[model samples]
Target: MFVPFLIMLREGLEAALIVSLIASYLKRTQRGRWIGVMWIGVLLAAALCLGLGIFINETTGEFPQKEQELFEGIVAVIAVVILTWMVFLDAQSVAQRQSTTGAGSR
Candidate 1:
């Protein structure tokens, strides 16, 4: 219960931040109308993903032992891939800074 709640909270905040960034960018650039469309699309996507998550959780709850293990393993692998990709992407700014500083010192 708490785990799902915390996960949902974090995911929600992250999404809210994304939308905020998009909206802010659009506003600053005088393209607020386009951002409205983008936000609607994002909301639709988030709704779909949430529905899919709920469906997956419900369906997996009915799985038997070995099959459940397989499903769990698959989910874990996908999560690991996504997590690693995110970490790499997040560190990309640091890499840019490192390169910039390294060149400046020469």
Candidate 2:
């Protein structure tokens, strides 16, 4: 329960960060009027996602155990792959910075 909550919290924060950056860009470009429209779109998207999740949960109750397990396993594998990719990208960036700064010469 806590794990899902934390994951959702992180996802929400990431989305908010992106929205903030976009909003700032729009404001900087003097396109502030569209910010309201962008926010409405975001809200609509959130509602759609919520509805889809509820629909899936309500419908999946009748699915067989094997299929449900397979779905969970697939989700877990995808999550692991994405996280591994992020970690590798971060490590590569750090190595590149160190090399440029001559900190890795030693």
Candidate 3:
């Protein structure tokens, strides 16, 4: 559904931002040569994510109707927990950055 699509889009953007930040830091620190290694790591991570998604999809499709419903409910609860944790971490990061920039003093 559109909800899952939006969730995936947001997660993908978050991942892209994280990778860009790491690459920027490496470049700024004159570690440009390690960029290839970083790319390799990124590719491996993406592959692993894709593999996991496919595995889950296949496994869940084999479940009986009642079990499938239960599995989905569990997955939804876990997703909510993970999303809440991500929001908390983001807020903490923002707070830390603001404090370091003396924005909190104002």
Candidate 4:
């Protein structure tokens, strides 16, 4: 229960950060008018994720114990993969930024 809540909270905040940054940048640059499509896409993604979660929960509950275990394992592996990728990408981005800034000061 807590795990799901925390995971969802973290993931939601991560996504929200990206959207907020884009929105803020747009406003700062006076291109805020184009934010409508970005907001719409974000809303659509949220809706799709919610719908998919509900469908997965309902469908998983309909399975037998063994099948449920298998499903849980698969979902866990997928989550691990996603988390790993996100962390790797974040580190790579940060490294690139540092390198670029270092080179620029030369």
Candidate 5:
């Protein structure tokens, strides 16, 4: 329960930060007039996400137990692959930066 609560809090903070950043950028660029448009876009995005989640949940509810397990396992594998890719990319970037700095110092 606490884990889920923390996850929700983190997601809410992320959305808030994104909106704040966008608003700041708009104000700095004198595009404040389009702030309403940005809000509309955000609302639409949120609605779409909610709709997708509902659709997936409802669709999966009809699946057999074995199929549901299989689906979940596939999703977990995909998530692991994506995470691994991200880690490798980050490590490569750090290695590149270190190599460049080392070369520059010599």
Candidate 6:
């Protein structure tokens, strides 16, 4: 339960970051008029996702409780593994950056 929430939080943050960057670029380029179109695109994408989710939920309504629990467990495990891997990679990169900066200072 907590793992799924964390995964959703991370994904939501990433999507927000991407959207903000694009909006900033559009404003800087004086193409702010297209911002409306961008927003429309965003709305359409969101709607599509919602619809897809509903369809999938309805389709899986007949799934056995045992199977659903197993699937959820598998997903949680995968999410944890992926999150751990990302943290490891991020730590490595940060360490490398610090070492390079330290060497430059020396």
TM-score per candidate, in order?
Answer: 0.51, 0.57, 0.55, 0.52, 0.57, 0.54
Worst 10-residue lDDT window for candidate 4 reads 97-106
Task: Put down candidate 1 lDDT per residue, 4-102, tens digits, no spaces.
Answer: 798678667766755665565567446788976996899799899989879988886567889978987897677667656655654564466568667
For model 6, what is the alpha-carbon lDDT of residue 66? 96
Q: Name model 4 segments beyond 4 Å from true.
A: 1-42, 53-61, 103-106
Note each model's CA RMSD in angstroms: 6.6, 7.8, 5.7, 5.5, 8.2, 8.1
Taking the tens digit of each residue's C-alpha lDDT, what string does model 6 give over 3-104? 989978986775575566567656744679999999999899889989987998888755688988898789778856765665565556556756866644
**lDDT measured at residue 41 in model 4 versus the true structure, 0 to 100:** 91
lDDT of each: 0.69, 0.74, 0.75, 0.73, 0.73, 0.72
> What is the Cα root-mean-square deviation between model 5 and the actual structure?
8.2
In candidate 4, residue 69 scores what lDDT? 86
TM-score of predicted model 1?
A: 0.51
lDDT of 3 by residue, 9-55 (tens): 97787677667766765674568999999999999999998998799
Each candidate: how many clashes? 0, 0, 0, 0, 0, 0
What lDDT tens digits, residue by residue, belong to model 2 across residues 14-40?
667567756765674568999999999
* Alpha-carbon deviation at 39 in model 5, angstroms: 0.5
> Which 10 residues in a row give candidate 5 its minimum summed lDDT?
97-106
Model 2 RMSD vs true structure: 7.8
Clashing pairs in 4: none
Which regions of candidate 5 are displaced past 4 Å? 61-106
